[model samples]
Structures are given as structure tokens and as C-alpha cells.
Target: MIIDLTTRKVKRVVKLPKTPFGITFDGESLICCCSGKDIQMISCTDFSCTNIPKTLMSQYSYIAIQGDKIVCTVPDDSKVSCLDNGKLVWEFKNESVLKKPGGITIDDKGNVFVVGMDSKNSLMISPDGKQYKQIQTKEYGLTEPSTIYFDKIRKQLLITNINSFAHLYDVSFY
Candidate 1:
């Protein structure tokens, strides 16, 4: 459903094939992590829907746009992947600390922020996808965090916990 924020009215309503969980815009279309085990692209101009074939996994939990690729978190496999042109371009190594990755976001520098659901923390990947750093320790009060958002303007990170209020961390120290 599209709403006109200026006039506060409903503009159009288009039904989707499945419930969208993680979504991102690639300038021209909206990419969604649909329940049908595929990435759905909704046209920004006409609201047309297209399902991209799933080639890497059975389900994708969260997604973020990283340059020309889409990085997605695979909860069931405890992995994260980058897809380009409906094909798996890269896959993060399945590490024990990455058990059940949920939320994901990428910064302008291509750094990846991913939620470690089982670890109750978040992992940061370098622009080259080589280095991994764990941030927001238990002492900082993170529990069952699911969603992550990066504020480029303020240089802060906002994370949502399933059972508690959202947490904000200043990333200016980085």
C-alpha cells in the first residue's frame, strides 16, 4: 500500500505474493526478502512485482544494499551472502559466532553490520569482507537483537532488541 504523506491519503494498494521481512531500494526497484524463498523486486515506477530465483539458500531473513550487490542474512544456515544479478557472488564464512544472523546493513564504505542472534551481539565486516569485529558486548546490554540501522549523518548505529528498547551506539570512535 502506498500512502501520500503530503496529503495524508492512500494512493495505491498492491498485494504482494508473500510477507516482506527485509527490504531495500536499489534506486529503481524495491528488493524484499519474501516468504516464498525468493527475492521480490517491486518496480518503483509502476509497482510491478518480479520474483528473483533463489540460488543460494532456502530462506533469507534480512537484507541490505551494498553497492551493486545485495547482502542477505541466512538464518537457518548461520551465514550471510552477497548476491548480484540473481546469483550468489559471495558468501560469508559460516562461523560459530554467527549463529542465526538476522538484521543487516551496509555503510557507504561497504562495511557490513550484521546481527548475531545467538551471540546476542553484532558483527562488523570490513569493506573487503575480510575482517570481522564483534561489537556491543553483553555488558553493554544487548539481548536478542534483530534489526540494525546505521546513521551515516550522525555516525551512530541503532539496534532493536526483541525484548527491550532499541539501543543506540556512537560509532564516531571508529
Candidate 2:
């Protein structure tokens, strides 16, 4: 998405990070990784934004929010966790399982969806931090997934493969 600074309209947008960035939409706010450990949220009301800290500034790579909680992904550490207000609510670590964890998203029911670069299976987690399902998209050619989003308006899950094309999945549950 291009950010219009009123005086000019920027194009070919980027997140000012050496590595790729992660993003998520929580209906009311647009959340993005700050290249640091925390994520930044742009308020839908006035376009104002503030950072959500997660211990330090380089502990995370991406973030997603469920309700008022902010859930972020840490690749090198192979984990994901959430911060409530300003305190850590929960943390999960599995180096053998979540290698290079990348994109993340949250459903209306607070189910978390995440994709990893070297993961044999994408993951789903309950709001309480219980991993529920593992969805394999290898058959669909998703070898190195980068981004995932639950599009409310289209009732579908949009996924982007690194340096590749994007695919849409029907997730209407209808």
C-alpha cells in the first residue's frame, strides 16, 4: 500500500528493513513490524501510530493481533508470543518445529495462523496458545511462504510465496 503524504504519493513502498516485513489488519488497525522486536500500529481514526514493545528491539520479525493483544513472530528464536497492553501474556518456543517462522494472521475467533520458511507444515493456534492444526500447502506449491492474510471482505485467505505469485483460498466456512 502506498502512503500519501499529502504533498506527494509514494510508490513501490517498502518497510525500511534489511529483511522483508510482516503486516496484519485487525479491522480497526493496520499493524506492521518495526524491524525491531516490536510492531507499530496505525490508528484508523487519525493515521497516528505507536510501537508495541516486546522485551527488546530486535527480538521479533513479524506481528499479528487478536482482540487487544499483539502476537509477534521471532524467526531466529523459532517462536511466537503475545503482549497484552505492555506486558507479555504468553510465549511459545520450538526450534525444531518453527524454523524461520514468517507471516502471521488472526481470525475473528482468535485463531492464529502462521507460516514458516523451512516449515513442513503451516500452523494454527487457539487463542489460549494451544496449537490445533497443521496445514500443508506443499501440494499447492507453497515452499517458502512470506505473507498471509485473512481477507474479511472476500472471505478468503491470501498467501504470498517469496519471489513468487500469490494464491487465494476459500475460507468462508460456509
Candidate 3:
């Protein structure tokens, strides 16, 4: 079962905090992060919204569900955080790599994958964010990746290179 938000019937649209870089469901509502800063939690039943944790997170480009944890990509730095109870329990940092990373996804096994602009490869973080792998394909990237997702059943990772292209690749391991 797949629900395409772009073509599907409008469930609802609650206003966001800023540019709304990424979104993920939080049982009762959808938590949308706007421009790496504010988080707006919108009700699934009516799309009503409220702020979660009562504090803005660090600047991030994307967020997604990695098991029960939330994987968030922090900006201006090559680091991603797996958060719990408003604290980062796991972190992945690369000082001399990754540039302008924008999108992220997680597999059913809880492996984390992230993409950045102008690169053919994306970073894959383990469930604990302690280990990482690089996911790449010849046709998929080496460009700008604005959006990305993992297809659980097929074990395929999809990359939406927003510069007028999209691609799919088999991601055997994260």
C-alpha cells in the first residue's frame, strides 16, 4: 500500500514553521520540520498543529523514522543525529566530507541513508549511527538530490534528483 501525497486526496494541510524540509508521522500526527529549525506537529484527524518538545532542534535538512527513533540531518556540518527524548543518543559526523546534504530515509531494518546535492553517492548510517556505508549508482546521482526514500519490500533505494531527474537503485546493504 502506497500513498502518494502529491496525487492523493487532501487529508489536510496545516501551515508549517518555515520551509518545511522534511516530514514524518508520529502516531497521532505528522511532525514536519521547517528549514532545519522548528517542528510543527499536525494532527492526522484534522491537521491541527502543535510544537513538540517546546524547543527548536538544531538546523537540519531532513528527518525520517528509523525504527522508533527519529534520524535528523544537521546542517553546516556533516553530521546526523538519532534522537530520543529530545536528546541525541547517537550521532554521525564527517568533518572533511559531505556537502549540502538535503534528504534522508531509513530501511525496515533501521539503517539510515542520506543524500546531498552534487554527488553520486549518499551516506548510509547504521541503526546506532556509529557505522556508515556509501550508497551510490551511476545514473542516480553525481548531481543534486532533493529527495530520497527506501522501498522496503524490493530493497531498492530511490533518489529524486530534483534537477529534472529521478532514479532507483538496489541497496543490498546499508
Instruction: Pick the TM-score winner.
Output: 1
Ranked candidates (TM-score, high to low): 1, 3, 2
Q: What is the C-alpha lDDT of each candidate?
A: 0.80, 0.69, 0.69
Top-down lDDT ranking = 1, 3, 2
What are the C-alpha RMSDs, in order, of all predicted structures? 2.1, 4.1, 3.7
Which of the predicted structures, 2 or 3, would earn the higher TM-score when compared with the native? 3
Give lDDT tens digits, candidate 2, residues 71-157: 778787778777787587777776655667777787777777777777734677677775656664667778678777876567678
Look at candidate 2 and give me any clashing residue pairs: 37-57
Backbone clash total, candidate 1: 0
- For model 1, the superposed segments whose C-alpha errors exceed 4 Å read 6-8, 55-60
Instruction: Report residue 57 deviation for candidate 1 (angstroms).
Output: 6.0
Clashing pairs in 1: none
lDDT of 1 by residue, 11-129 (tens): 77867776778888778988888765677788879989888876333454888885577888888888888877778776786566678898999877788899888878898887666
- State the RMSD for candidate 2: 4.1
